[model samples]
Target: MTPLISPRARPLAAALLCGALAFGALATSAQAAFNPPIRMSHGIEYMSGGIGSDEAKLMETVLPRWPASFEFAIKDHQGADFAADVHVTVRDGRGVALLDNVVAGGPFMVARLEPGSYQVEATLRGQTLKQPLQVVFGTPTKATFLWPAGTDMAAAGTRAVQ
Candidate 1:
């Protein structure tokens, strides 16, 4: 013989279970709707210099600023037998850094940023290169940068280059 739940308690238990299930579903849906506001991508290439020698390396960074998050991609296009490291920095019009790091093996980087204008810069080794970017609130913006081959210690910086 097994004990059974009382008629009065059975309805209460059912109601509570139903409420819990509904709450869980709502929470899951809310999480799925979240998004970022910034996106970025990068690429690299090596160019020949004088005397058939590797001169400068070309590094490219692509940025796509979304309404909720920032996304980006990076690539390296260098000649044979040469590779370069790439770093990226993003700042607001007031020279505030939003994102900065070295990208090695990734298709893109995304971040959440406030609505406004921004500047993006990319660097290779230590030298400073030019890769300006702009971001707008409630909209999307894209930017790209190019670096020459044989660029050792290439460093890049961006600050409200409006």
Candidate 2:
């Protein structure tokens, strides 16, 4: 028996199939782009991201599993969260740098580090703030930095980093 389908319809069907496959590949890649990287520190696994609601949600879900976490925020003396471009550095007890040259995209950052003494330094507009933190077992610690209100952050030339 001869097939009843026409040649013209076969080419149309093949084109449609190719288009669908291409769409699927693109969709998968797009979703993967949103996935952030998880880094392991001194036997502790952590991820950092609080730039937007989507990343915030991801950090919220991951917080419970990690024993220690660090958050960065630029707030005025009144304690209002404000956006600012700041450079962050973390050092261990021996003055060895744990993490350096990290730029926060937004006011908040979450990270996990081993339970120990750490020194956190944030630089903004030529002013530096230093804070000492200790991470204990089973207790999730948070550190917040508040920038003075009277100063003008805009003149500092703030920029967001990924």
Candidate 3:
């Protein structure tokens, strides 16, 4: 019996299959790294959301099931979600950094930190809002970091005004 593929085409086909498999592996890993639950040091796990209407809707659905912990919501003084170009840093009372990362595409970030005092610093639109909060066991702690009113999202690289 003769092989269906010509000998000359075997290497090319093999290479394409390997490339596709490699790409699929990388995509799966990257997706796992970002979505559903983001883990941090000291037993802190977080979820990011509200970057779009669809995602916001999904978040609302899961809002009730969110772990009882510290919740950080970013918005502007005008009550608009500050969901663009954001940086978040959470430090414990002893100044130990617990969470330090950029908010890729969300207005809300939830972290289950150990019950204690923490400082949450959120930066957006070239402005920073630092908040002091405490998390208690069995109680939900929420903190909203707000940007100054009339803050220019475009100027902060948060959005491009057309």
What are the per-residue Cα lDDT tens digits for candidate 2 across 65-160? 665555544455445444445667788899987767476554445567778998988776666789998988878777766666544356232323
Model 2: CA > 4 A from native: 1-34, 39-46, 77-79, 82-84, 150-162
Error of 3 at 5 (Å): 43
Residue by residue across 96-140, what tens digits does model 3's lDDT show? 877775463565567776678888887766677888978777666
Q: Highest lDDT: which candidate? A: 2
Q: Looking at model 1, which ten-residue stretch has the lowest summed lDDT? A: 49-58
- Cα lDDT tens digits, model 1, 1-162, are 654878779989899999999999887764444211223423211111111111111111223333322222222463212222445566768886655554422212334556666676655556555545554665655443444445532223211111
Ranking by TM-score: 3, 2, 1
lDDT of 1: 0.41
Error of 3 at 125 (Å): 2.8
RMSD of 2: 7.6
TM-score of 3: 0.60
Query: How many clashes in each structure?
Result: 50, 0, 0
What shift in Å separates residue 8 of candidate 3 from its native position after superposition? 58
Give all candidate RMSDs, comma-separated: 13.6, 7.6, 8.6
Q: Which stretches of candidate 3 lie over 4 Å from their true place?
A: 1-43, 63-81, 155-162
Name the TM-score of candidate 2.
0.59
